[model samples]
Target: MTTAQIIYEQYKVLPKRIRQELKLLINSEDEAEKPFSLMEDIEQGLNEVKLIRKGKLPRRTFADLKREMNDAK
Candidate 1:
């Protein structure tokens, strides 16, 4: 049998909760490897803002970032 058929056969033997958990684990892993979508980027940025607001992320001004970039060269 093909690899997919083999996997499906194995998956069929898993209990319902185990199957659901496995599906979630696989899907989350797949999503983690994908390039960020626009909406995902926006949400990430929003999360960063929350961190900044809570003083968890260092706030850098545009000039500070530009100077840092120049210094890195």
Candidate 2:
């Protein structure tokens, strides 16, 4: 079986309290990784800026974004 299947099988046998603790641990790990994920997003935005500067991608005005957000609301 796959590693995920093995892990799921093991997790299934865990007691309720242990499962809750595991969930907390998993959430904290996600929290720790968030800053790195934000940096990745910033890098992606910088790449998009380069594309916009080269005229490979269309750029939108802040007013256009504001209008879109208001429409969504």
Candidate 3:
């Protein structure tokens, strides 16, 4: 069997919570190498910065997050 098959066999025997954690780890590794729609936003921000050497995307302030939470309730 391949190494992945061996690992899959080992993973199948793990506890539910352990399996979930392992799944997350595997997903994160996969995400790092894969392109997704969310990454397009990141790439757009990078492109925006290139247009103006000193420009950067605005970050959400803590107060803004707090206000948003309050509004949601």
Q: Which model scores highest in lDDT?
A: 1
Candidate 3 lDDT: 0.84
lDDT string, candidate 1, 1-73, tens digits = 9999999999999999999999999999998898888999999999999999999999989999899999999
Give the backbone clash total of model 2: 0
Question: Superposing all C-alpha atoms, what RMSD in Å does each candidate have to the true structure?
Answer: 8.4, 11.1, 10.1
Cα lDDT tens digits for candidate 2, 1-73:
9999999999999999999999999999998876657888899999999999999999989999999999999
| Candidate 1 weakest ten by summed lDDT | 31-40
Q: TM-score of every model?
A: 0.46, 0.48, 0.40
Backbone steric clashes in candidate 3, count: 0
Which pairs clash inside model 3?
none
lDDT of each: 0.96, 0.94, 0.84
User: 68, model 3: CA deviation in Å?
Assistant: 43
